[model samples]
Target: FLTAPTMDDKIKREILPAAVNYYQKRRLVHRLNPQPVTEIAYYTAGGGCLTSSEAVLRPKAEIQRLRETFADGSELYLNFSDKPWVIGGRQIEPLGFYASGPGFEAETGRKDGLWFDWYGDADGCFLNARNYDWLMEPKGTAAMGRGPEGAEPQFANRGDAVVKRGPLATDTAVAVMREADGSRRIRFFPQKQMGFVSIDLAASGFEPAEVVALDAEGNPVAGSLDGVERGSGTLTIRHRDPRVWSFRLTPGKGRTGR
Candidate 1:
């Protein structure tokens, strides 16, 4: 969370000068939209630096002093809309937060490193020195990836779908659903990249005796499926580029489907 502007504000005063010099040296523009850049920053208290007219260059030594002065005991708060707010035909929303220095900690008890809070609603993802993970509490689903020092920063979710990229190269997307007819489906999207995605279907409220994979156009794609603890199942999608894919899980033989 953020507070109103403070009185001991030398550091905040330096922002204007640094930004003016930085932008004048090199003009910046929106990468995806290709529009003339106007806004530099947006905050709760005020819209950020509007123009570069009064910009000045500060000495490196002075800048370093300010950096050290403001490094400790600082909290940055950001507020974003839960749904998309479109301007100029682009969807902009608060998507991620990155933290550094010695202030934050992971649930697993790690310290003094990078931690990320991703997502906007009940469904979102997170990455830190401790681990890379995703969770959707309302749906009772979660997933995690293992990387060296737990710095893997590639995962996202929207609603029931989870997207991830593993060590090889391929990307995978999965969504679990329960149909009106009391059957269940796990939708999978596999990209051409070289990697594998492991999806857990336990939390979506279905347990499977067998699973089958199919392409977007209703063609079967070769893959492997196996059951996990608690009668749930894991789908390992590997080395395929079917534009849209899904797996329909069959309830345990002679058991009612969820």
Candidate 2:
């Protein structure tokens, strides 16, 4: 079980996975307005190098569709009439705490990694709109993903193979990123010319992936490059937010550096 405080009682404690499950089970009778919603503005302060920007999203048809599909799961954005939120905004304290049995985990995973260490453990938590439009309420107020109107909506397992030929001639490294919910993930595979090719992100100012050489059957071939002619290198990208990601890459021989 977890403990959390609300506006009424910053010291109040709540139950856990049961708290989360109760809402999920009661979702059948709950629903938000069927009207369209909009994201007039959004803000974020410097929580870190990653999430420190302001973004104004005009809900496109695709974004709207995504929201509608996940309505059941309270994953959609909700209007916080009195609260002012920024992109990197965090509550002064948790709103409430909930408890769960052994089968409770977050959609992101165990939350026990170097990256999440400073984020805290078993503290307070809250449920708010995803895109952060105070006037734009979600279809449902449950704390889970429902459908396309839900947070993760379909949560569909998509598997596809991509083949491309471009500046990235050789293969390098590969990785698969799985969310805690055990649904969607992004795969990174090394390309011949480009160091790393991500099935998740496209080209950006972010660092290119560290490309390793690969053999004939697409197996990683680890070796060192001595001269500019060998044509080998590395790249890494760190995330600040969903929209902003960092990047770095190796310039081929005689090429201008980024």
Q: What C-alpha lDDT values do all the predictions have?
A: 0.30, 0.22
lDDT per residue, candidate 1, 1-258, as tens digits?
122223233333443223222221111111112222233333221223212232234322221100000224322222232222333333233332222223221111111222222111112112111121332121112221133333433323322222331111113333344445454555432222223445444422345666566566756555433222232255454434444355555667665433
Error of 2 at 140 (Å): 9.4
lDDT per residue as tens, model 2, 1-258: 012312223212322222222322222112223322332222222221111122223322112111111322323321221222222232211111111222221221111110000000121111111111111112233322233332431211122222222111112222222223222222222112223233212211122224333344534434323111221232222221222111223323453221
The alpha-carbon deviation from the true structure for residue 98 of candidate 1, after best TM-score superposition, in angstroms, is 15
Please give each candidate's TM-score: 0.31, 0.18
Best by lDDT: 1
Clashes of 1: 4
